[model samples]
Target: MNILAIDTANNFLSLALHKDQSTHIICEDIGNKQSEFILPKINQLLTENDTKLQDLTSISYNAGPGGFTGLRIGLSVAMSLAYSLKIPLYPVNMFAMYHNALNTETNSIIALDAKLGQIYLAGFDNNGDYLIEPQLINPEQLSSVLSKHNLINDDDTIITGNGWTAYTEIFNQDISSQNIQYIESNYPSAATMINLVLSGKSQPCAAHEAELLYLRNKVALNLEEQKQSKQ
Candidate 1:
């Protein structure tokens, strides 16, 4: 099966083409310009590989809890292509993409910086099975949450993601005694995204159903408050 996988949920913009069990990827840490570069890169990849959008069996993307703008661009492209080509669109979780890149078989916690002094977090076991549902958490609450799951006492636990890089001091202070190892890379891989779909880890949805995996609901001010603020 020929599959096109995209990952623009973070600072990295990655696109992969899977053909006959081999994968080709265009990955770069080009922050915030994914909206500008993604489609051109996709066209370049297909043209260079002698493939066309119509040849794609499926379209997969990093459905996110990462940067809101990046996620929107990725979903927009994926859904548009899938709908036009009449192919299924697959939504892969951003955290699971991170977990798939880990070299360790131990318990893994994937985190992404959620800003507002919080982090997006999820846990997976050695087999890549989710242990905790993804959530946004304040750094100050790190200790209690891990302890609640007994992860605080588990030395085999490893934390990996950009979340750690952005809030190192807070994580170090809170979980240093736990002896959890940290890996430096946080960017999700389009190659891994393809591997995930090939292994049946991702599910395909209708193009209209393709949406960002935001863990939180939309926040809005009340009508009276909006009027007061405007005044």
Candidate 2:
């Protein structure tokens, strides 16, 4: 099966083509100008691979809990591609993509800077199974939320994503555990997107069902709701 994967849900704009048992990620571009270059980059990838849009068996993308505009752009592209090509679209989370990016298993948390001093967060066990449902929360509330839900692990916890860079001090102070491993190099990639495309894990959905996975219903309203819920 041939699958095309995309991830523009963050600063990174990447595209991958998965064929045979090996993954061929033609390009993984990182920049702030996703809106300007995403489709052109995709076209370049297909042209380089000597493939056509209709040749893909599936389309996979990072559906987000990240940037509002980036998420909308990526999901729109994925849905449009799937609709035009008559292929299934899998809206995988950036955390799931991060999980598959891992070369080895370990208790890990994936966070994406959700702006306004909060992040989109999720966890995975050593087996890469989801330990906590994905949500948007502030760095100040992260530790307490984990404790309230009994999701804290004494084992070394690996943390990755743009959030780590943005809220380093807050996370460090809140986590408290001495065994935290922070990875600063990697970002979500179309290569990780291919993991789902190749696994055949996504179900075909109607065009209407294909939508952005905004962890928070209304990004602008979340801060008010969080404050009200706390009060």
Candidate 3:
């Protein structure tokens, strides 16, 4: 099976082409230039791998809880390609991808810095089951959330993601005595996303039904309203 996976949910733009049992990936920290770089990179990957879009069995993408513009660009392109090719589109959560990549044996918190001093948070057990649904949360509130779940003092608990890199001091100070480990992975793996689909963890949907998982919907709506007011 041939599968294509895309992840433009953060500063990194990741693309992967899985053909047979082999995978080819292109990952770059391109900041805000995903709109300009993603398609060309995709084309380059396909061409280099001697595969075409029509040859793909399905397309998968990181469906949000990251940067707004990046997620939109990724989903629009994925949906359009799936619609045009008449192939299934699989939506994978960015946090799930992070969890899978970490391949950890302890309870984990997958977070992404959502800007405005907020973090996109999701928790999973040592066995990779959801401990908490994904949410946009302030740094100050994270301690309480962990305490609520009795995860605060668990030495086996670890925090992983770009969120830690962005707000290191805040987390260090807030949860200083917890003895939790932090891994500084800034972006999820595209290869991991493809593997999730192959393992049946990701279910495919119609192209038109594909959508980004923007956890901060209310904040997004408010920003839109503010923009309209200025206009």
Candidate 4:
């Protein structure tokens, strides 16, 4: 199956085409400009791989717990394409993609910067099951959120996401220095979304039936708010 995957859930635009048992990817940072670059980038990836939109059997996209505008742009594009193509649209979240990229072989807790003094946290099992569905928590409550959700029941759990970088002191209080594992958040892959779809880690639906996954109530970011999620 020729599958298309898109991830504009952050400052980056990542698109991948899974075809012929091979994967082709294009990822770049075009901060706050996803709407401007995503279509062309999708075309670029498909063109480079000798493929077309109609050739895709299904589409997968980063359905959020991420940047507000980015999620909307990604969903709008994926929805439009999938609707027009009459193909299935698979819904995957940024946390799942982030955890899957690591291939850590252990359950992982993902804590992304949610701005407004809150962290967007979620956890996934080794098999890509959600131990903690994405939620917003104050930085001070990071430890409690984990405990309350039974998220990090063991010390070996892999902790990821940009929240670790943004709120070091807060995370250090929860995840000890010795237990700290830094898996850079920039490594998110649209290819992983394709793999998740093919593996049935997420289900597919009609484009019209799909919706954006927004953990935070608001999406638009001011310059200072944007600074809150650096890296």
Top-lDDT candidate index: 3
Tens digits of per-residue lDDT for model 3, 104-191: 8999998788876789899999777889789888888888888988888888899888877778888888897787788766455799
TM-score of each: 0.90, 0.84, 0.89, 0.87
lDDT string for model 4 (62-145, tens) is 898777778889999999999999999999987878887888788788888887777888888888888887888888887776
lDDT of model 1, residue 187:
69
| lDDT: worst 10-residue window of model 3 | 180-189
On a 0 to 1 TM-score scale, where does candidate 4 land against the true structure?
Answer: 0.87
User: Candidate 1 on 1-231: residue-level lDDT in tens?
Assistant: 999998888788899999877899898888889999999999999998899888999999988887788999999999999999999988899888888888578998887887655788999888888777799887877778778777876877888888888888988898887877887774657988887898888988999998888775542334455578779
**TM-score top scorer:** 1
lDDT of each: 0.85, 0.75, 0.87, 0.82
Checking candidate 1 for backbone clashes, the offending pairs are none
Q: Point out where model 3 deviates above 4 Å.
A: 220-231
- Worst 10-residue lDDT window for candidate 2 reads 198-207
- The global Cα lDDT (0 to 1) of model 4 is 0.82
Flag the better candidate by lDDT, 3 or 4: 3
Give the 10-residue window scoring lowest on summed lDDT in candidate 4: 175-184
lDDT score for candidate 3 against the true structure:
0.87
Cα deviation at 74, candidate 2, in Å, is 2.1
